[model samples]
Target: MSLRTKFMLALLFTGLAAVAMVGGLAYAGMTKKVDSLRRERAAEHFHASVTAYLAQYGSWEANRGKQGFDAFMRSRGPLAGDRPPPPDDERRPPPPGAGRPEPRGEPPYHFILADQEYRVLLGAGVYKHGELLPEAARKNAQAVEVNGRVVAYVSPEGVITPSRQELQYLAAMRDALWFGVAGAAVLALVLGVLLSRGLGRTLGHLTGAVRAMHGGSLLQRVPVESKDEVAELAAAFNAMSEKLARTHEELNASHQTILTQAEQMRELSVRDALTKLHNRRHFDEQACTLFSHAVRHKRPLSMVIGDIDFFKKINDQFSHATGDAVLRQVGEILRSHMRLSDLVARYGGEEFVIAFPETELPQAAALCDKLRAMIEAFPWHQVHPELKVTMSMGVYADLAAGTAEAMLQKADALLYRAKETGRNRVCFAA
Candidate 1:
């Protein structure tokens, strides 16, 4: 079950058990006390009736019979079957103890009656008429007095019969008990709802926070609305979440720093130190991939090898610093003119290599010729009085050469032929 439901049920059962225990005990104790009081009042009233009867008649001689007061009791009691007809104006006087209301049923407790001489007058289904009351039984008998003279005695315990008044009181007490139960139940339900809702609200916030953290948001806050244990737990959870988020951020920053350093190291490994272009190692790897792609897709591919003409002589005639300037300028020019798809790298000292994907021999050779002319027209006289500079490039575009290494070798042969044929020119495999 949900947390709210479990909490509500726990409260509801607790309230009910408490109310039931207390209410049931109260109702039972009240029932016992009420019965005791009813029985006592009945005994006292009966005693008073007997005393008045003797006072009017002056003896047991004038009762239902001189046979005994049992005669009078049998006459007025339940076994009489039917009551006598209404008295006429000339009717005889009413019988003894006839002043009581009609009995709805059996009396709550039957009684034993005796004269002042301790002679049993009524047995109450326990003793016979005119029997001397036992000494042991006489202890429980209450004296019936008339004008300060004891006339008879009455016993308080015998048959149990609930009269109308007793039943009415008991029923009222029962109703009150039921009402108490119902009220307690309703109170429990209301309390359960109220308390559980408050608790559920706190739990809902915790649940939502956890879910958000599960998603990409690592930081969250929840309300601390109370000082109860639940509130303390929420506070603890908030602390833990904040710490976790902070730890995650730290880990991410460290990871990013490591990745950046690794990337820089990788770049340095494959880059030429002086020219800032890809070195031969990086070029060979990319050239192999480009050659494979061109051969696999049956697409045009081109390879070119270019050399700075008379580069060693320039270094010998002037200083190598001037030659370094020329090489940097030429590498920059190649880098600036190349498309994103082209790969240009300094192959070795004063030499360069280029690979062009998706380019035919004609387009490759024309591009190489343009680069040669640009290098020839550069103002090299600034380096020395007679200084001059130029480049020779050989273009080879044919995947039939089978590998990037083989194609570059063919371009190198063409580059040699270009240097032999002319100093500042581009030669192609035409």
Candidate 2:
């Protein structure tokens, strides 16, 4: 069951138990009080009957055989609910001085009368007329006397039965107690339900906030609607959500910064600082990969290694800055003639390398010639009024130079041959 139901049940049970206990105790106490009062009344009646009998008859012997005892008993009211017993041996008269027997079953409460010698005369509560009283019963006997001589003893037995009013009072008390208990239980149940609902509503807000946060809404917050502990918890949760949101933003910013730095580091590692072309290390790595793929796939692959002709003369005659400008231009010319599948790198000072995938020796030689012409036609006079520049290139294609270093070395040898033959020309191995 839900907490609300459990709480209501608990309160109801407690109220019922308390009420039941109190009712039981109250009933017991009232029963005892009523019983005491009844016993006192029965004892009083016993004493009054004995005194009147003694005043009229003088003694049990004086009143015998004349119906004096029967007359006296009949004169008294009923002893509890017992009626007088039938005359003893009605067909025969009592011997000159005998008294009538007291009845049996005296309504659960009556008096027993006996002479001073403890010879019982009238029995009470199911006792025979002449039966000797037990010590337990005799213990409560009261002696009646005249002229300093004990005449008779009266013993009360079960004389504490409650009267009608007393019984009704006890019953009413029980009913009232039970009614109050039921009322208290109902009240407790109502109060418990109210308390549980109040708690449930407060906790619901926090629960909703938590669910939202689980769904990736880190900014979700609970509202503090009261000054109770639940409201305090909501306030704490909102604060925590805000902290989480801020932390998420800070982490995202840090991640972006790290990515930018990583990209810059990667570019610096592979690119030449001056010409902005792929450096020698990047060329070696890429060349090996392309060469292996081409050989394995039986595809055409070519290499063109070029050198700036009279590069040292340009630097010596004018300035190194002019030579650097010319080198930058050379990189631009190589890029212009290259496709996306080609790799171009500054191999070293005044030397450049280019690799072309899916290209034959003849096709590479034609591209290299184009590049040489472009460099020769560029306005090198911008750096110096008289400075001019050109490049010689060599092409090697479809050769099984197993490694990148081997392929580059073979192409460099071809470039040396082209420069020796003439400047500003392209040469290729068939």
Instruction: Give the Cα lDDT of each candidate.
Output: 0.83, 0.80
TM-score of each: 0.68, 0.68
Write down the RMSD of candidate 2 (Cα, Å): 8.3
lDDT of 2 at 212: 89
Candidate 1's residue-wise lDDT over 1-430, tens digit each? 9999998878778877887788789888987886676667667656765776687778877754434444443444432112333434645555897885553333345678888998988777888889999988899999988889888888875665665565777788778777877887788889989989889999999999999999978888889999999999999999998999999999999999999999999999998888889999999999999999998899999999999999999899888988888888889889999999999999999989999999999999999998888877878787567878899988998788889999999999999999999778888893
Flag regions of model 2 displaced more than 4 Å: 1-181, 295-298
Work out how many backbone clashes candidate 1 has.
1
Task: Give each model's clash number.
Answer: 1, 0
